[model samples]
Target: MFELILGLPLLGGMVVMGSGWGISAVMFALHAVTLLMSLQHRQSFYGSAAGIVTCLLFSVPVWGMFGHWITAALLLVSMVDRYGAGMPGSFRRS
Candidate 1:
């Protein structure tokens, strides 16, 4: 399932780019991938929801790629916090 995060975005980017949206397609994939990964840990959904919105904005009035960094930052923080608990599937401390 983890691999799906990257694979899905690449698939989505290709489809969106086919419409001639170019760079916006990359932005869309960026947020979508982040949203998907974050949703996996079951922490919250709203952040991922926001990512989807950012993906949409990329297709419209959003003219810059910087906003994708926000999604990446959130993903980074969430992932760091997750691993701090120790690797997934490892035995937990009492």
Candidate 2:
């Protein structure tokens, strides 16, 4: 369910990219990689309802920009939250 945050825009981006939207391809890569990193950390979206909403907002097209601003801001905020929670930047599990 929460994975929709990562999936929706990703699929949409892929479709858009198929139509020759290069920017969508970039955004797709960005979200796919970040989402994979989150999974590698075993981070669950279960309690991050805010992420769902933000990502939903991110899925919507705003002024033909694909909501990159919202998604980028949420990514920064989420990274801060995870780091403050003692999740180090390294890939090693503690």
- Write out the backbone clash pairs for model 1: none
Q: Candidate 2 lDDT (Cα, whole model)?
A: 0.48
Query: Residues 1-94, candidate 1, lDDT per residue (tens digit)?
Result: 2212322445544644565765445655765776676568556445456556656655432332334445555555555555554667864433
Which residue pairs overlap in candidate 2's backbone?
none
The candidate maximizing lDDT is 1
| Candidate 1 lDDT score relative to the true structure | 0.50
Q: In model 1, which range of ten residues has the least summed lDDT?
A: 1-10
Prediction 2 TM-score vs. true: 0.42
Report, for every candidate in turn, its global Cα lDDT versus the true structure. Answer: 0.50, 0.48
lDDT (10s digit) by residue, model 2, range 1-94? 2233333455645655566755444555555565666678787332243343444454455422334444545555665556554555644433
